[model samples]
Target: MTITSVIDPAIIQAYRETHFCVEGDAPLTLRIGEKNETLSALHKASGATSSAFVTAWNPYSRRCDDETNADLQKKLIDELTTRSLCFVNGVGRHPASDWAEPSLLVLRISLEAAKELGNRYEQNAIVWCGADAVPELVLLR
Candidate 1:
């Protein structure tokens, strides 16, 4: 399936307006793959210069318990950081009306790193490029 097919139109529009539309650059391509392989590929492709904004969805907010949710949230953040992704910012709940409970966690890393990370985690990897009119999703697996 194509990236357009899987992602919602509203999301594409929001991302375009907030990310791509404002930034004038090449449109990013989203690629999916297994964890280790994806990281390896990203490292090889980036050659040390390319960087991207990485975002992850934290669904624990929907759960009933605050403590458990907090723990999970910390775990997610720690894991991502451990992998070398730097924390960027967090979008408040419901940044996109169409999206559900999960709040978004944004991080910055190499564009190649984001592509590989997207493959490793579900609903967390997004590639934004300035060249495209909208965000495009590609699954490498």
Candidate 2:
């Protein structure tokens, strides 16, 4: 098993407009030796509409200015939802509403579906924004 840790409040704040100052560490586990098969299965499960795995980085962070942050946030959201499955590690739940955002809603629903499908990886906890920095999910990880 490989455990990857990524914490980037800058991108979190820039990419995610719903929630700024992300704080928390979500422990995720990727089972070893099945990455290829797992990805293929997920791709098939996603149907033809979904895009294959794609990697994008959002440079936007909460600390960024208004205009720049907005651009980055859009890019982040676009990248986050483009893939068949997103494996995010650090980042707390968006405030105001749990399913307020589309990406978040998709993530929540995907997590639930994965649970039903017996996905081995599950989010373990949610830490507040002030508690810790958030991590971005990347393919190279």
Candidate 3:
């Protein structure tokens, strides 16, 4: 599916506002392929050092207090970490934000690894290739 079709416009807007011009002048290209094969190729191409920023939103929607929100965020982080796909970078929060339950979780990961992680949680997750001049929403099947 296209990024616009699957992602909430509010979330996209928040992202744009919070991360404006973050991608810099680095160029990026999206590639779709089997997960393992893609990872191997990426590793070979970048000497096992290529990595990108990735973000994932909370799967549930509930207006919780700050404590509850923190707990939920931790759970999401743990889930993602256990998969060895990425590590928590930080959270994206905005006043009256309507996307992601509380805030979106950020992590640094390789493009192929992000793709693999997105595939595992395709129903409620969107991953981005965030290391380029223009971050691309990765479509995982």
Candidate 4:
């Protein structure tokens, strides 16, 4: 059975338009369903067959203050740190929107774990990729 997302179409569109960027060392940008050579190389170099792009901002697109978002994101980092997961700091930004959020490229994370993290943070969706390095949107709403 297929589950329909309750998330708004506009929000979903914004997600599609936004750039999922991984920062540090070699910066990389991920576009939904697009194969990224740099990302594939990163996966091969790190021996990580999968990666999840997640953020803890604007739960369900309800726009929270910067401070609240920052604190929530810090908590997310703490959770990843506790798990000893390898993650890199990143940000998601849309070309037409000024709003941007702190994000992370979590290496070697399972799809289930990524879904759990997205739900735990009350996000509408996340970007996940496998060894193919093609990002796919996972809606949680």
* Candidate 4: residue pairs that collide: none
Task: Judging by lDDT, tell me the better candidate of 3 and 4.
Answer: 4
Cα-lDDT of candidate 4: 0.93
Instruction: Assess each prediction's global lDDT (C-alpha) against the native.
Output: 0.39, 0.29, 0.42, 0.93
Candidate 2, residue 43: the lDDT equals 36
After superposition, candidate 1 runs with Cα above 4 Å error? 1-4, 19-48, 58-73, 90-108, 124-141
| Comparing 1 and 2 on TM-score, the stronger one | 1
For each candidate, what TM-score against the reference? 0.41, 0.23, 0.41, 0.96
Evaluated against the true structure, the overall lDDT of model 3 is 0.42
Residue-level lDDT tens digits of model 1 in 1-141: 335345456544444433211111222222222122332334344442233444334331123355655565566567776876544333322333544232222333545656665554444335432222123333323
Candidate 2 vs candidate 4: the lDDT winner is: 4
The parts of candidate 2 lying over 4 Å away from their true place are 1-62, 84-141
Superior candidate under TM-score, 3 versus 4: 4
What ranking of all candidate models by lDDT puts the best one first? 4, 3, 1, 2
Tens digit of lDDT per residue, candidate 4, span 1-119? 76578988888888988899899899999999899999999999899999999999888889899899999999999999999999999999998878788899999999999999999
User: In model 4, how large is the Cα lDDT of residue 100?
Assistant: 86
Residue 122 displacement (Å), model 3 = 8.8
